[model samples]
Target: METTTATGGVDEPGWDVDPDDEIASVVEALGHQQKRWREAAGLGVAEFATAMGYGEDQVRKVERGARIPRPEYLDRADEVLGANGFISAMKEQMAKARYPKKVRELAKLEERAVELSLYSNHNIHGLLQTEEFAWALLSTWRPALSKSELERAVAARVARQSVFERSPAPELSFVQEEVTLRRPIGDTMVLRRQLERLLEVGQLSNVELQVMPTLRGNHPGTAGLIEVLKFGDGTAIGRSEGAFASRPVSSPRQLRVLELRYGIIRAQALPPGESLAFIEQVLGET
Candidate 1:
């Protein structure tokens, strides 16, 4: 049996939350494995879906693990597709899947990013979030966690900010919808401290803050938020839970679409010089 030795009574890393989390990751692992098996077998999703007595849509969902494959479904799929043990092996990996895969990808990207650009709709972007904000946000998730879990989550999020202080720090730019400033996430004090932090943050030459106003008539990004990242290699990617539907889009076609919208939004937004004043204005309003 594998052993986990404690150091000063601290739990070791790699422990998972629950069966659900493990199952979630396995769902993804299964999906990827199934896709590989299908390719090796020279089959298409539609063809495989038909063979397995499932619709194309359901097949896609199964592969993505957005929908669990019922035991009967899995048995039939395994029999028809010849993926003998893939689904069963996911029991451990699924525990890691409770969180969204896109979220985990974003975390990894943030850690390695040399620059990050943010645009938000309903809430403050994660990189700018404070402990109180993060705790409140995570606590509101369904299948609620205990206080210790929430703290761990909050700490994990806050610790991610250290990338900002690394040698030759990454550039950070934020574009927030004007409504966020008025939302009042925490109480007055928390909100005030947050806004003050924003001011201090905005003062950094490597950081910029911009606000998109309601007055800027409806446009592309009017639908949701986006984040564009430029990495150390100087390759850039654009992401929005929007157009390519939240998938990581490094393709020129997708990036151009997002790039065009981001450009217009920036133009309609208060420029950096005015943005400082705008942040101060909201701070005064609080």
Candidate 2:
């Protein structure tokens, strides 16, 4: 009912939200539709949940994209709202969709990069994800994925670590925002395994990991997450703020801008050895 006001854009209703934006477009559409109906009916989440035979918390989570809807629930809701198979089509999109475009490019880059550097602000980088951790994160989304998509995601994610396996090995480094270490992804066991994996990988000759100190009073990377990828023969690409559109950094000025910022961030971060110790301290091993 209030969908127009919710979006507030006279020309745009909402986002197409890319069919495979990795979070599952089906689920994303479900969320949009639910919000559309709720506002149309002039009801709050709790009231709507009661009407739909579910808990208010569940409804709220769906609305906020913290959970996915079951197919049967969607069918029932669709019939009630006279949406006429809109949600059903979205379910198909969820099952058939491949990985999102951004992630797909990242997968390619992982395989191609001669050296990779990542800076994480709010969460662990995907390339470093463990199987359980990746699945746990993916399964919690609103449009649930099929088993195949899940497996593809897992394989692709694990494969990214193979950059460490190259004979020469790509030069790797990560400057993690202090908050990432504090965010407990997956369960304690999953997190512990991930940390242990980090230690193992950090020991590799080509890899370096640094933690930007939460207590450092001031830091250069406080600006945002940055990933500057260097390829063979001095070619490179860059992604930032979060993908303002992954652009080429071929020009000397662009490359210098990234290199300078990255250098400053790395300098401000703890040294690799100290960073490992800092991680251990956060893990309560120290």
Candidate 3:
């Protein structure tokens, strides 16, 4: 039999709640409520843990707001403490709290974008990556992340895919370096699936996917990645690795520079139809 952690799932650990997170107060309040309900029922920590089928330490962490309780844990606690549906109702908020801060911020920006222009030289853009591909790529980070951290990061990346499902979808344009397609981040099958995903996304009416061949020779994108997001309010934000210290810029002058670079990069890349064919060929080779 496999040993399970206090989080209840096999080999899965509870997420450590970040005290500085924006949702920290909400989680703390929920934890306090859980504790109050248990005490009102005249249950001690050990007794409560036994009732909920979790370890005492884990239960203590949840009550102290140091660990984020999983949905099942919340449901069990609600049933055991007779809180009715109150404890379980916090699951949706807790789910959002589990994602990293940066992911949440970026997702909000993507949600507001009416048009997105992007150029990625090192790897496939996050929006175009498959779940397995994202996992394999993130796993290569130095000073390796813990299992809980890795799973959370992958979840955050995959969650951004919701942008593709939005009604009146945003116009998405992407230019990827030739090498990104050839590099197998996970395994043969992983790369194949990722390539297939690119083909499918490329076919979307609102999306245009292009590839910059390795021999394309000294382009504006050679310096690094570029991104520009335009909104309906006649405002835009942009950033380029080679300019503005790579920080986001919103002034028209700065935005214009990034747009120009991105425009040239797109023009130099393979056309959408040819790019899809190229990706399909790469998939076959895989």
Residue-by-residue lDDT tens digits, candidate 1, 62-98:
6765554444555666677677776555543333243
C-alpha-based local distance difference test score of model 3: 0.86
lDDT per residue (tens digit) for residues 1-286 in model 3: 1246665633222577789987778778888999999999999998888777777777888888888767778888899998989999998677767778877777778889999999999999999999999999999999998777887888778877878998889999999999999997999999999998999999999999999999998789988999899998989888888999999999999998999999999999999999999888888888
**Residue-level lDDT for 50 in candidate 1:** 61
Ranking by lDDT: 3, 1, 2
lDDT of 2 by residue, 99-199 (tens): 34546567667667888878877677877777787777777666886664565566456656666777767899888887776667788887777777677
Q: What is the C-alpha lDDT of each candidate?
A: 0.69, 0.66, 0.86
Instruction: Evaluate model 3: give its TM-score.
Output: 0.85
Which stretches of model 3 miss by more than 4 angstroms? 1-3, 6-13, 36-53, 70-92
- Candidate RMSDs in Å, in order, are 14.5, 12.9, 3.1
List clashing residue pairs in candidate 2.
1-40, 27-143, 68-142
Tell me how far the alpha carbon of residue 275 in candidate 3 is from the true structure, in angstroms, after superposition.
Answer: 1.2
The estimated TM-scores of all candidates read 0.63, 0.60, 0.85
Q: How far does residue 61 in candidate 3 sit from its true spot (Å)?
A: 2.1
